[model samples]
Target: MPSHGAWLKVGGAMARVIHVFRHPDRFVSGTVGEPGERTFYLQASSESKQVSVTLEKQQLTVLSERLTSLLEEVASRFDTEVPPSAPEELTDTDPLDVPVEEEFRVGTMGLGWDAESSSVVIELLAITEGEVDENIVLDDTEEGPDAVRVFLSPAHARAFAERAERVINAGRKPCPLCDEPLDPEGHICPRQNGFLRDNPFTEG
Candidate 1:
């Protein structure tokens, strides 16, 4: 467990500090604001600590897809049991226990498998001073920006992948004519020469 003071600070030249959560009770990806104006978040929590970080939709999508692919590869290569799918009730919801606030926006992310622990490691990095708050804490002995590190069991990783897939797909329906997402007020499809279609995506 990180000291309370350590949790309070995260800044510096751009160093990578690994804060590992071995088995978080809740690890989730969520969004705030409307679709176009949305802010994405990836949060993880144990009984004693919680961390939230800002991320982009593109990042979330890539993470989810990569996780799924990794799991498949691991299962096949090792002949291990496939990670179970997330429960249906849990797939389409945000499992945030605390209110959403960003610790820092993710600049770059890394992922790897820990063969010894049989867990997936996720590293959230703040690559530059500009990506971190100057007020964030840094030890006198420490240098560079801080990174948020998390480890997830295969089941939890699978759950996150499922939840992320649902969230990404829960946006506006696509217009068949132009393949552009339709707005609530409707979209003027370019393929239709800017014609306003109330329902261009009818079921076949």
Candidate 2:
């Protein structure tokens, strides 16, 4: 599907494009690949348009956590009615939509609450080789990098954050000793003085 966003042409060249999903039917974070080797993606889709952007696992985790904090802040500061958690009916367990073509790898992300609409706004900017101008982030200027902007309800945002937590935790189990991911075969544990523990979890 074609990406839905604003396109600016400067000097006969495309300067930037900003995809906006004002009322997306679905906006989610999903993965493609096995647990340890998975590629994380944030997808926003409306009736006929879908945009997917890749990001690191840690980025997704931080995004989810920050989103939750933002919601709490909005509630306490603005006296808004934010759901404590995602509603069960809104829980999305389905896989990502098909044709998972990546539009870009996310470099920086911006998030905020739209007081007028009471919606959570998420902006994902495409990675660039050079430094990003902070002012361009979450802005409508035509000179910034390509971006995807998704507006969602507070409940929907809660659901997205909860789902992200699940997707992140679905990765390989971590070794308790060193707090590093454990390989199925085995890994040398620093707690064991560079020795490979046959059963790392066992308290020998």
Candidate 3:
């Protein structure tokens, strides 16, 4: 996948913590058993009393680093559910330069999701080495410290994508881009850009 671009915004205030993962573009949505095959949205939380924030790679790195402590126990409780892929390596390139539709995995690893902490715990085993592709972006940014974003292993990423798909799918959400009532596939909101939302309650 190529690191295309995305835009996320929050219209309502509810949870104090909301993490967003943004990428450039991709050929598929995320799933549980396997990591996504391409690069896409990878943004982090939007705290600090601001409804939103544009995260560079560094902020994303710091955010990911902070999550390590939050994931310890989850890994222990649900070790069986995680899968194995590859590890992510540091690079001198920028992630945005990568395409969104490429396939990349970190290493042979697994991921366990903890509902309590709302994080995925990663267990890196030595058996499998890390894997990424030519498009994986890791670079510096002048907006803050440096622009670079890291990711969970391919297996773990697959797990997260699966969970994200379920969670995002389950929500009674209108499309972020279209504002239409989202259904099984997705929504088509006219208010979003010009498409009409098919409201189950309202008849056309």
Q: What is the TM-score of each candidate against the true structure?
A: 0.69, 0.83, 0.23
**What lDDT is obtained when candidate 2 is compared to the true structure?**
0.85
lDDT of 1 by residue, 1-204 (tens): 243224233363344454556667678887777655777788878787787888878898899999899888888876456656865554537445567777778877777777777877776766565554443432222444556767777777888898887666556678877877675566898998888878533211
Judged by TM-score, which candidate is best? 2
Residue 31, candidate 2: C-alpha displacement in angstroms? 0.6
Candidate 1 vs candidate 3: the TM-score winner is 1
Q: Rank the candidates by TM-score, best first.
A: 2, 1, 3
Off by over 4 Å in 2: 1-4, 174-204
Global lDDT of each model? Answer: 0.69, 0.85, 0.31
* lDDT by residue (tens digit), candidate 3, 77-172: 654333332223311122222223222222222334535434343322111234522231221111111121323433444433443343333334
Put down candidate 2 lDDT per residue, 1-204, tens digits, no spaces: 123586788898878989999869999999998755789999988998999999998899899999999989988998578899999988999999999999999999999888878889899999999999998877888787899998888899999999998888677576788876565457789998998755333110
Question: How many residue pairs clash in model 1?
Answer: 6
User: 1 or 3, which is superior by lDDT?
Assistant: 1
